[model samples]
Target chain A: MSAGVRLEGLRKSYGAVEVIRGVDLDIEPQEFVVFVGPSGCGKSTLLRMIAGLEEITGGDLYIGERRMNDTDASRRGIAMVFQSYALYPHMTVRENMGFALKYAGVKKPEIKAQVDEAARILGLDQLMDRRPKDLSGGQRQRVAIGRAIVRHPEVFLFDEPLSNLDAELRVQMRIEIARLHSELKSTIVYVTHDQVEAMTLADKIVVLRDGRIEQVGTPLDLYDDPDNLFVAGFIGSPKMNFLPAELSGGALTLVEHGGQTVPLPPLGRAPQEGERVTLGIRPEHFRKEGSAALEVDVEIVENLGGETYVYARQAGSDVLTIATGGARGLRQGDRMTARFDPSDALLFNREGLRIR
Target chain B: MSDVAAHRLDPEAAEPSARAALRGPDGPGRDMIGPAVKYIVLSLAAFVSVFPFFWMLVGTTNSSYDIVRGKAWFGDQLLVNLGNLIEQVDLPRVLFNSFYIAIISTVATLLVSSLAGYAFEIFRHKWRERIFAALLLMLSIPFAALMVPLFVMMASAGLINTYSAIILPTIANIFIIFYFRQATKAFPHELRDAAKIDGLKEWQIFLRVYMPVMRSTYAAATIIVFTLTWNNYLWPLIVLQTNDMKTMVLTISSLNSAYTPDFGVIMVATVITTLPTLIIFFLLQRLFVQGMLGSVK
Candidate 1:
């Protein structure tokens, strides 16, 4: 009963300012796709358009090969879990779960059975008689999920459902959602600004920026092979670092830090000699022992028990982070040599697009 | 060690100086008096406000001469006043008319106003917002100025003495619409989105989801509308031409205009007119306050 979704140049605008400028994407059946971006980047708006909650200013939307641009939201065969866990405050959990089913023309007995099954699945059976105001935050969220589940929708839409929960509850609910997706095997589109939730939950992550899709790929693919500096910086925690460099004879020469030089793999569209480019490196990509090394002074050491992040500086730029194993004997004002393999570094042009 | 020993021996000195500072010159007894005085003042104000209602009830049982003479206690004239009220007016028919108009108006007003309010809040557009703002401005126009035009409109529609004339003109009241709009600010937009995705049409969502969730708001609006419609004087008087179509408020007013009117009977009619609204308010007081709190929040 699952349906794949496709958007061909979907656009939304409020009068003159276009919030969602032409976005095109293909979501496979049963594929958990996440739209991740900073706030005001039109992530939620894109989700709303797909859910038929917001009007599409231009372009076509297709669900399972049927053009659904003009279809009412109710006929779209979808369900959404809101960030606020928008359960009816006056209705009990069972009533809230069964409310939508009544309108769907389901029999009374069938509605009760579906609601009871959903309550069991979400472990909300005991709380069925309780109103939303009486339930805790986590329980209310579970009830919200149960309300969506009883619909047995072809597709599920989540608009930052875990954002309102506490940090610990967010982690717990994130896993529960992942389990729910697998058990139901329903096509789902989730929106969130938290990269960790996207990385952990999405089968394919669609990175958006300024109302446009930057890249769409698997979580590991995005983490390892980003197509642009923005994706590289946005996908990883602590963000990827970029150093200014000039290309010379298929080799990159750093201009800022003591003119260090690193060689790049041969490419068909490699920059000409003396052309400026950026070198991208993840914090964890740095090695304790490597062929290439840069001397720097440790400015701050954040020992997070399992791993340590050393914030250091080289030359005049305060733009270096070194992830090391365990808590090393690192202190402020200590001068050390940070090393990394040349092949692990990413090269990007001035336009922020990666160069292979 | 010796200094510590000396300090420990003096328990008062060992106690933190901050504790002594907190005690100050006045003890806890002095703080208690302030709240006591405030409560007494509030109780007196409440008593003064309620005294008139009590006086009116007392006046209903006293003779007209005794009432005008400023008698404040109940006298043995309740049956006499009841007889006079029955003799002068068709009390049962007037009461039924008042109730019919008030109940019908309240129900229709609640449904129309709440629906409009929900629409204004949930379905936001540039033109809708402009229209809503214009409606808010329209609310500032006094009903007095529009009464003549409204009456003319009703006369043209041939509904001069019908309940439809009273109810139809007041159904789309801008004040109740604005009240619903303001109360709807507390309604979470997320619920609407969830309902939309749940395969429910807009109207179904409104009736099944929105109305049930906003029960407190409905209760509060019911009280306000019932009171307004029941106590309606000028409009009903102008429109209702027959004594059979007269509301309790109109009947009471006309009863008081006799050359030698019976004040006791008038008092009884006034109490009868006021009782329904009072009962409605008392029944829904909790919901009224809760609904107001929800709106303000």
Candidate 2:
């Protein structure tokens, strides 16, 4: 059975340096929540704290209503799959899968039965006799997951589990992990720096920055409506293009892009006139017909068969990425007018706070 | 293109001449000189290393007078030398003493030092590195400098003449501990994490996970500690007051110091003393190579 996890004012520190600063989160039972962040953002640290691998410095951590700050990692009803696969090189796949069960004093036959069931789930029945070194990287990862599954943990924690796999294998394993969560109906807290993995697999994506949760929402919420400049820039692949702007009389003028004025996006609250703000625009939001347009010098054009990305720059401005739907016959040094809807742009204040 | 230009450009056309040039006097044959010199040097080194064993073997089969005359070939004195050495040395009791001390010392040293090494590498604290640095600094202090104090301690404990004096000094071997610490660095920390999550406690992880994973390292340590203990002469000579308690190396030293030393018997004793280390090296040679390279791989 799955159990929910809750962290109340979680704080982790090393001497005077605090890495996790007052993180409070609730993970619903059987929900797949992903902690997504850049490097050194305390995502992995928080996950480790939840799993009881790391000592909770100042926090109340609850796994299914029980305070687990003092509980040992093994007794916390959590299983973790490390990025390195961390399979014991000396143990066979079967032994590795059944290790926790054996240590928990389960009978030999029961251990075998559980291992077999996990193997069947992961399609690892053929490779049970082999050691970790003898198997492929993907196979070794499957064994690691199988090892976690045999214990029937209420919560499964994955710390960048697919970071070590090759690209194709990473996609395959990502799907497999999502399937496993559904089949077992268990709560899972997965950590990854790759926003694509977070977006594809997470029921709720917790965007973290500088050891603090920046925003928490569904994939589209984070993509379409990021809470801040950091989340706006982080979530999407070919990340959201940010342009400097200044509010001027119910419209925003691109400061570096020839003072082109566009109508202000509709918002609950608007910034004061003449205030400097950052404009966030997703690459895919650019369209051939829109109310706003910027004439730019095309620096690079990348054709990916089905779509084309035009990296263009305005005078004294950062290069903007525009995803043209298909091959546009655009070339480097070509002058193009990139167009987008004014309502699609997101505005952030000087402190990087979203204005709306 | 012109035919001559095309010919110059064609790798197929240039192939035969290139092959012929490689097979010519200044090409492939010239490379042979490097290998030839290497073999000559290696053979000289091999002969230099093996000649002492050959001479010792020849001395074992020769009389004292013949050995003194530099006899480099076999003779009929093998059984006589064996008989004389056996008669002089209480073979079974001396073997027991050497084996007992060496085995006990090796096992104890491996257990103690490896545990120390694992702990030194695994645990984290403010003092961990400073204490380890002090231990490393202790490695540079010569054994000769510490021997007098160690002897005094043993003498005060009434252990000077006991086997403890010989075994106790080496149990917490700094060099082996350093070796184990370096090897343990290659030990994946994630395994310990996994074992902890597998419900194994710290000590159980050391035994069930660390020990088996690091067997090659243990085998390598066993060979090293066993050889050092077996061939240990100076320390054993200083502490072992009784002839029965002396190791084989001490016995050999005593034979060498005799007023009228029997060369044949000395050679036989030397061979006997060397056999155990050789046997150990042979048994653990593959694992020793693996351990030295990095046991984790």
Interface RMSDs of the predictions, in order, are 1.5, 0.7
| Candidate 2: residue pairs that collide | none
Best by TM-score: 2
Residue-level lDDT tens digits of model 1 in B1-297: 698777766645666664445445564666688899999999999999999899899989999999999999989899899899999899899998999999999999999999998888877676998898899898788889999999999999999999998788778878878878888888777777777777667897788778877788888899988999999999999999999999999998898898888899999988888899999999999989888777422
Per-residue alpha-carbon lDDT of candidate 1 for residues A169-224, written as tens digits (9 for 90 to 100) = 99999999999999999999999999999999999999999999999999999999
Name the candidate that leads on lDDT.
Answer: 2
RMSD in order of candidates: 4.3, 2.9
**Second chain of candidate 1: TM-score?**
0.87
Model 2, global lDDT: 0.92
Query: What would the per-residue lDDT of candidate 2 be over residues B1-297, giving only the tens digit for each residue?
Result: 988777666645666876555456576677699899999999999999999999998999999999999989999999999999999999888999999999999999999999999999999889999998999999889989998999999999999878899999999999899999999999999899999999999999999999999999999999999999998988988999999898888888889899999999999999988889999899999999999988997
Provide the fnat value for model 1, as a fraction from 0 to 1.
0.92
Please provide, for model 2 over A228-272, each residue's C-alpha lDDT reduced to its tens digit, 9 standing for 90 to 100. Answer: 989998989999998899989889999989898988888899889
Q: Which stretches of candidate 2 lie over 4 Å from their true place?
A: B1-32
Question: Cα deviation of B262 in candidate 2 (Å)?
Answer: 1.5
DockQ of each: 0.63, 0.80
lDDT of each: 0.88, 0.92
